[model samples]
Target: MMKSLTHRRLAELADVYGGLFHLKMGQLHMVAVSTPEMARQVLQTQDNLFSNRPATVAISYLTYDRADMAFAHYGPFWRHMRKICVTKVFSRKRAESWASVREEIDSFMKNVDARIGSSINIGEMVLGLTRDITYRAAFGSISEEGREEFLKIMQEFSKLFGEFNVVDFMPWLGWISYQGGNLHKRLDRARGSLDVFIDKIIDDHLEKKRNKKNNEGFDGLEEDMVDELMEFYDENGGTSNLGSAVGITRDNIKALIMDVMFGGTETVASAIEWAMAELMKSWDDLNKLQQELADVVGLDRKVHESDLDKLTYLKCVVKETLRLHPPIPLLLHEAATDTVVDGFKIPKRARVMINSWAIGRDKNAWDEPNVFKPSRFLEGGAPDFKGSNFEFIPFGSGRRSCPGMQLGLYALELTVANLCHCFNWTLPDGMKPYELDMNDVFGLTAPRAVPLVAIPSRRLT
Candidate 1:
């Protein structure tokens, strides 16, 4: 958020309060950590105390008591919810079933190819790519107006998140009528729309459940996860390894959907934008990657998911992108009990925020703290970085790390590989690469300040 959103302000904050310090925005208390070791211990070794976020007024209302996985505290429910999401929602098999995702990706490249011939907005293009894939994967299809409803809600959520509310800091003042507080009002409206939409899906699934009572499930496809989980509940007398998969409520479903929709779209988009920005920032490194891609794979055949196995340098670039600009720089990990990190005591109930950005750029760990170098990742096989890695963290580590890491990687690999394979992008209107503003904005994910607008030319053009 610091580097991406308001760079100088954070730089000043870092200078004033030191890299790791706490700040309160209205009622919301945030401890922004920059050092890898400190960030790591909060998320990993001494995670119990650090993971719990100090609940704010927005969270209290918006989250339905924070029952969702993203905000919920660690306990049986957290473990159980994560398990269901990993095995049932974001399963290995579920990902494999959606050939449409690849098809949509291919469509995306075509759009990019066509747009590059003209002046295209890369930001809109990438956002569309993410939005479509996310909708399809979560729900069964993307054409419905319901899909648009979800997207609209997410966009509203992002916008509202950007504006600061004084009420969040001064809860005692409570419910201030500032524009930032309007986010809560907007959220309530979003919940109404989303609830009705999700309810319709659930009702339809319930009807399916009634019809299948004596006859097993329908379509073999079972289609949506709701149906599948419902069927499983019916079959097993209502209990999963995670506990009773039985009464997964509307709120539960919505919460999970929110986590997936928001986390799914935002982070992958961040990775794509960062990769492109970095490539533009350093042409020599960018060309080296392009050379590798060209030598092994060319533009005629799109960069397929199957091709990722051989594209080592491309993987390194993606990994390095994560290192430099991890979508969630500080993963939120809670302390389960009393713990200590780097000799600092973390009492129970302390909320931990790990700073992946500072860790990635640490002089102690990386040769150059600020420079973008993909090859550095190539030094180590596969570039593993959990909370323990201390030097790098993108998808987080330990139990609370994002389950959609693979999905994000696939989207990143396929899209970025195709972009490099197809386009010869230049700063729009011949602006020098360095002139491209790398400014970013703070939110759940860090987005470019001045959007990355590049002129795309075909290999022949």
Candidate 2:
């Protein structure tokens, strides 16, 4: 399983065994859950006990020793961080307030226009678009040199996050990974690069705050995520009742910002890329979606966020795309304590892998599970992805569910809508729609195995 795609392999095993099965690998106790009922048992029924993440060596190092909310041990501090994320960072109001999103999208449109007649890598394009939006939102203004360097580091971070480390599974073989210091050296370099970049951001923010205090008419800069976090970092001498046992530190702030960047960028881009890929392969669905966008958004103007709700078909396409290609196929969680789930014994500290990709295609749950039919969702009584519908949680459910879901979904919907509404896309090099490769490369997120390349022609005047 370690040698191949873990989720696909686990799903294959589930087919022969059952929806739920256990495997003991070396010192690790592993359990794979593929059915909705079993998923509910773990994600909802025993959510608290299974809420904690099982961080690998890379995860712990990249996440600053579990300081970030995504991998933090489920506790008061996690709850506090989640509260801030909900109320401040990923809040609906904050998402709505982000003009940077529109600016970035407009810039992306301009880039797309520049190469309309030629083949372009849609996946790479969307990746850069989301990266810029995330950077601007998280840190207001930055040099392109800094942004590009940080992006390279983040790519390394993502690669390492999914890299195999023998130490995580068999602690007794710890020396194997450290024999050459290759993995440790990479982890140190990645985290060190982040520190240099983010530490300078923190210092700059502090200097600006100081200047504002000293100067009666100091030029105020718009607050970015760093500014927002500094309020908590400086609260009550850094000991605010934000739910932590101790005061927040620079590491905490940096970790939280990393969470925002990681959560926001590639995940959204991956979803958008998949949506485009699916649409490119299915012309009838593509035409229907484009028609809906045309009717609601109109060709004369770009699709706005306010116009999104009216573009129902566009939403359905997104749902169908996520159903087929969930950004994270395997939802990783660890058992906090020993307990029984669905009449089966679950040991404490056991690794629970929820095969959401398989669950999405469960024949019992979906009609023609392999088909990409957006109308399945357009019909009444469709399961929504907002946690209640276990059969359709592209974003997982319960406490460990994605907090930035609203923002990410907004980005996906808006980008897809604009891309489809403004342009007519076709496979490059005279390639047929059926020839477009939909196979994905699994990692932190499963993006396309081959980057999507297509030609665009303006559909609107």
Candidate 3:
């Protein structure tokens, strides 16, 4: 896996060995699924048997022993956490309630507007926007010092989490491997930094609740996620409605907060950055999208959430971007029971990776699979990233699909539309559109290998 790019290597191997191939990485038995039919078999047909997560050192440490929803094993606890997240935190009403999204976008656009006619790192700006919005939505309002510290910790944590630790494959040799790589030491440092800040956040939230200040709780008309979690803790006596057998602890709160911060920030930022990069490379598509935005949302006003649904071309651009560069290219899963997928035996405890990147580029499933063509999505009977269509699932399918899909799309589409609507972008220093580097820096989420620096001039509506 280290000799070549992980996703591409997996895809090449899948082609040779067929869509579904099994391999042994040390003591680990791994299955890589690269085609839509095989994806459906694992993600939809036998989702339950493969719903468990294979714990890694960094993820386990960061997620408070897999107490968070994303990496938790498939069982009652996972179901409970998923229920709370879906119903309380990530519900449509909850996502809409964050009026701060508009405020943050306004600030973002103003910053971009201020830099008109000059080069700006659009990727960096997009990352900042997503980070600010995620922080404000989670902790209500945080001090600058706190925000900086939290963001730094999160950035390090994300890098560490995405690293391929040798210990993950060969657990018994972990002690010897740590001496050479210090992976354990790094994980401890990142986890410790995160724990300090998150603990402070939870403590502050509890203190605010004790003081009974109405103005301090909600960001605007709605309670932030922490406030909601606190309410749940109080109402249920620190236990989830799942039962007293399993309870929400301070660790649980911190874990969920970590999930929200990491999930909300990086994935949306990556999508927007990739979308911008792709658009810069495809000027015709960019013009078409901008034209759609102009017809729907005049230049006198900024693009609003309400305007997003009507910007059909913009949606197609986003879908195309995601299809080519999914935030999470490989969906990780662990087998909970022995099962047969396409006549092959999948033993319990086997690690399963659904190669979303490969599936999206499958020549059998898509026409000109490598092309950056948003019109493919605009055609009749087009596929979407709603987890229903295996061929185009930027978000994974079945029970363990991304819970924040709606909120993520909202952020991605809104940011891209506003940027395209407000300005006509060109590569910096008179660079041609075809000269832009499209290489990706892979991690838990893949971002552009080169930061997208472009000059933006305000467009006439």
Worst 10 residues of 2 by lDDT: 234-243
In Å, residue 191's CA in model 3 sits off its true spot by: 2.2
TM-score of 2: 0.95
Model 3 per-residue lDDT tens digits across residues 401-430: 999888878888888888888899888777
Q: How many residue pairs in model 1 have overlapping backbones?
A: 24
Q: Would you give me the overall lDDT of model 1? A: 0.68
lDDT, candidates in the order shown = 0.68, 0.85, 0.83
- How many residue pairs clash per model? 24, 0, 0
Give the deviation of candidate 2 from the true structure as CA RMSD.
Answer: 2.0
Question: For model 3, what is the error of residue 146's alpha carbon versus the real structure, in angstroms, after optimal superposition?
Answer: 0.8
Candidate 2, residues 34-124: lDDT per residue as tens digits?
9888898888988989999999888898888887889998988788778877877777777432677888998999899889889999999
- Show where candidate 3 strays beyond 4 Å: 95-97, 142-145, 177-181, 213-222, 234-246
**Could you give the candidate ranking by lDDT, starting with the highest?**
2, 3, 1
Q: Tell me the TM-score of each prediction against the true structure.
A: 0.86, 0.95, 0.94
By lDDT, the best candidate is 2
Where in model 1 is the C-alpha error above 4 Å?
A: 1-30, 53-55, 96-98, 161-163, 175-184, 208-222, 228-246, 333-340, 345-348, 380-383
Could you tell me which 10 consecutive residues in candidate 3 have the lowest summed lDDT? 234-243
Candidate 3: residue 20 lDDT (0-100): 94
